[model samples]
Target chain A: QCSLDSVVNKRIQEALKEYKPSIPTKTLSCVSITSSGRLSSCPAGMVVTGCACGYACGSWDVRGTTTCHCQCSVIDWTTARCCHLA
Target chain B: QCSLDSVVNKRIQEALKEYKPSIPTKTLSCVSITSSGRLSSCPAGMVVTGCACGYACGSWDVRGTTTCHCQCSVIDWTTARCCHLA
Candidate 1:
């Protein structure tokens, strides 16, 4: 049963791979979910900016550093996503 | 003086604009610092993922939704950058 499940999962993953391209093109940053039900790691030369948080992150002052920072709500930064500076 | 600051700010912004291309094109999501030293907003189709935080945000299960989420350390999520799922 486990083997069958693994095969099924692999097939599903393969299908997903075919369905999607390695990201559109010239994409600076992108997001992806994983089997563990979480966001996947970033691609090359990219980093994950945890824009969201459990508490309210008033504002981020990452100026003079790189491209920019993410936008977080005044409420808990629960919806924190990622950004890429391409 | 404030007026001069505004003018200088505008000139600096224009210079920065020329120095940078509107995100180098095809950006799914990105970050930018503001005059006040805060992150700018996301682009049209994409949203900001606050993957970082002052507290620890374990793996975010955004698998069902769109592509994925950001990455945060077990630490205080300080270095939480951004991701663009391109």
Candidate 2:
């Protein structure tokens, strides 16, 4: 019985190997979410990777792994670069 | 024989369902590559999601989907936010 089960498992494994090519490969997808003021946030299921701020502000940080906070004193717009596996 | 093949296919489907839990889920991973001067690039297999520039410079663009170029005249540094599915 054990030998038969092993044979069945082996067949299944081979089938899986063939099936893999049919499975769609997932790729990294990203989008920028921009909002007025100093803060911008990623949409649901996305994470903030980096930020861009207006007034030529280079200083920024991520908040809650989803929002980008621009640290410059005079910031007008903020953009959160968000990414996810798709 | 057809019935036997159907049974085997059904078993393989069941095995695949069980096998799925063991497969590791892919997630979005990101890192920032910062370099002195005006340009920075991501490592192989990663794509640039966004960019940051030093000296309070936020004007930046991605070059060829991997490198970040700071556009400010006196830019001191550039950071490329690179991400990939892992």
With a 3 Å backbone cut-off (N, CA, C), the pairs that clash in candidate 2 are none
CAPRI accuracy category, model 1 = incorrect
DockQ of 2: 0.36
lDDT (tens digit, per residue) of candidate 2 on A1-86: 77666666777777877775334578768899999999999999898888888887886766676888887789999999888988
TM-score of chain A of each: 0.23, 0.77
The DockQ-derived docking category for candidate 2 is acceptable
Lowest lDDT block of 10, candidate 2 chain B: B15-24
Please give the clash total of every predicted structure, in order: 31, 0
lDDT of 1 by residue, A12-82 (tens): 44544444324435444444312111113444455554423233333433323222333343333233333
| TM-scores for all predictions | 0.23, 0.63
Q: Whose DockQ is greatest here?
A: 2
Q: Identify the candidate with maximal TM-score.
A: 2
